[model samples]
Target chain A: MSFADVNIQFLEAAKYTLGLFFLTLLIAIPLGVVICACAMSRFRPVKWLANTFIWIIRGTPLMLQVIVVMYGPGLIFDVPMKNRFLAALIAFAINYAAYFAEIYRGGIMAMPKGQYEAGKVLGMSKASVNGLVIFPQVVKKITPAMGNEVITLVKDTSIANIIALPEIILTAKNIVATYAIIWPLFYTGVFYLLMSGVLTLFFKWLEKRTNYYKA
Target chain B: MAFYQVNNVYKNFGDVKVLKGINLELDEGQVLAIIGSSGSGKTTLLRCLNFLEIPDKADIYLKGENIFSIDNTDSAAASNADESNISEVENGKNIQTDSEKNQPTHAKKAKPEKISKEMRKLIDSKRGHFGMVFQSFNLFPHFNVLKNVTLAAKLKYDAHAPKGFARWSKEAKAARKQAMQEINEKAVALLERVGLGEKLNSYPCELSGGQQQRVAIARALILQPDILCFDEPTSALDPELTREVLKVIRDLKKDGHTMIVVTHEMQFAKKVADKVIFMADGIVEEEGTPQQVFEHPVSEKTKAFLAESEKSIDEE
Candidate 1:
């Protein structure tokens, strides 16, 4: 195959990889906050249920979780597996949301009690206290941790290949088989590197912006 | 009626009784300084007044309005208070209750009432009556000095704005913009009063401890509270910084602001306080004019505390 053909194939596959990454993040970030709230809920049953879900998702490997999400339903329930990409997206989002929830909880719990008291004494309502005073500080704290997960997610998108989602790695491997060349496989590293490098810079800028406030 | 009155307030943390049947009354334009060693519940008392820590039983009146009252019918808590009192006496800590002597009997028989949502909302609304300055100067770190001072005021204004008009209406938007301008002006004036006129854009992290505390003071003052309570306002500052914050506080006193200051600065207490209270082991050991408390303390506990404080000052 010509370099142009390989480049075209890799670029098309990169679209899938980028879509999965962005969509998973778009869903997971907000879902993580919801899960974190449930985990931290004053209601005992809700807290336990959220914590158990987080525990199972986090304790297992992502590849296994994805496989289970993709195949387990059809195998056990005898339901036909429909959208492979959607299944992978669901698995990735659920897995990452669990991790993000813990990071969020850690950030929030690490906050000084004085922050809440400061808001209370200011006559702010409870919702306003958390929304204005607490969450902004929590975001600053969770940024570095969230950034780490995001970079990991960039590479983890390749795991969708197991479900034959035809992402970048799968396309590169197909080229390796057809053209009997290996560099296309190695060339895929450039895409991951560029994406992660940009993310690293973005996170660094975010950290710097939030550096205006110190805990 | 007193401008602010804390009647028969009691607070407990599990088995530990923090404030036991404390009663304090302050009139308008008066500064009451509460002096005590650590764990004497002075800070807890201030927290109770600010509603940061809800009292188990308290009748808090602001401008003769009963802003917060909880009747703890939990007989268990009353007995727990008594037990803690015995433990305090056994520890050889004086259990003086000159003001609280009659409160226990009254509190034990009261019916237990939970802090209902309505009551909490009421207390939250009434919280504007008291402004609190914490020892740590808990200014919102994410906000600049001016933003920190103006934030609560703006929130209050937005909450109370007329709801008849749509938020997007020109009249409503104009009113909001004008209100914001006024809040900013008031904040700038208060910051300037606290000697932070030039640091209005600076974040809390960029300022020194003294400057942060002053910002906290400005933040509190902008709310126009009926009373300002300082919980060891200068305890976290260096001596020089302490003097700077105390100077602002002294200036506020001269401006006729009523304040309750829980502090360890004996000299400042003596000089600035209209009334001095000495608390020990969750009770007021002595309360009087500065001359009476500092110069002629009646209780042995107060005398020992003052002497120790003076010796520490001398050594420093």
Candidate 2:
């Protein structure tokens, strides 16, 4: 495919593509935090709820999840999830939240128990100490893990094509269908490759800034 | 505490009872050393006085008030005082209504919930009016020495932080700063006290075991706690390092910081201990002044344990 052809298709899908990446981020960041808190909760009910959600999401295929979102709401409640793109976005958001939650939980648990005891001994309330002291350390410890999830989120944006939402991969597919060529599909990799490359570099900056959190 | 006491304390981890019925007391200014064999539960007993180990149905007190007793008197008093104040305010009292006065206010109901949460936090912080110095020197590895010492001061003293020239009071900002400075100075006096004045800025990873213990000693002493508990503060060091840390404790004795030390240094305990507790299998086998217990141990367990320790030391 010519550069002109590829650019137009890329631009066409760019609207849906941008919506998925940022929208999923908005949903996942908060849901991920809650899911992480649930997993860490001492109550068995909370832990089980969080773990079961994570297990089911992780166990199933993303394509199946997209199909479920597209039709399941309409089937169960007679509320049509009118836009397949919105269905695609919701499915991807929930799926990646479960993944990001694990990343967060892993980071928090790996912190030394001594830090919490030190906080207590120094007269810190459990909530204040964890927020001001432990959370910063957790953020630092989890930066690499979080970075991996974020970069993967960028690549996984391609999965929106499963619900035919016209993200970069589907944009490339439509170009192939319109013009009988495969080059645009190959060039789609470049968008992901460049975006992922940029994300990896950004995390390196985050890691350096957070180097103060020692074990 | 008006005076610190450990009375008839007993503890066991599963079947292995570590402390049998034990009774002891320290006046506000005296230092007491507990010397015993490893696994003798000296640390366990020291922790009990602080209610660190909640006995499986036993009593521990500070200033003679049952600390482990869960009657909720402190919290209840707080809530009652608050309720009376609210009722008084509702009936027209002089208290400035919280800034949200214009709202019909969920807060009269919410205030009790909020205050109780705050009260629980306050009570927990109050527990550490006495400080702990671990053998490993559990300094916040993330912060500098200055930040570690000032941390409590910063959080406790500063009520409302603002912005601009007074965005935060430099003094308020330096509540921690001043605590760090005074801590640094006292720590220096303590380092000079234990002779580590030159090593103030040093991190724990960079210091020798003896030096780290000295820093731990300085950290605990900086608070001027009613009683300072040592969990084998020098036991981790080599002989040379052990002497270095011991010299610091000796200086603490001179300075009059009340201390409950868990030690294996028999000679050190013999020299300075006003009371000696010989613990075996968690019960106090026998306890008295170092003179009474060391020179003429009454229990066979105490006698054999001391003799065996002396023999081992002599061989070493």
Best by DockQ: 1
lDDT of 2 at B275: 75
| Candidate 1: stretches off by over 4 Å | B76-114, B312-316
lDDT of 2 at B171: 68
What are the candidates' individual DockQ scores?
A: 0.48, 0.28
Predictions in order: lDDT: 0.86, 0.69
User: Tens digits of per-residue lDDT for model 1 on B154-215?
Assistant: 98988888776587799999999999999999999999999999999999999999999999
Residue A134's C-alpha lDDT in candidate 2? 75
Give the winner by TM-score: 1
Clashing pairs in 1: B73-B112
Per-residue lDDT of candidate 2, residues A24-133 (tens digit) = 98998889999988987757799899999999999999889988999898999999888977898899889988998998888776766556655655566667677877
How much is the lDDT of residue B306 in candidate 2? 81
lDDT of 1: 0.86
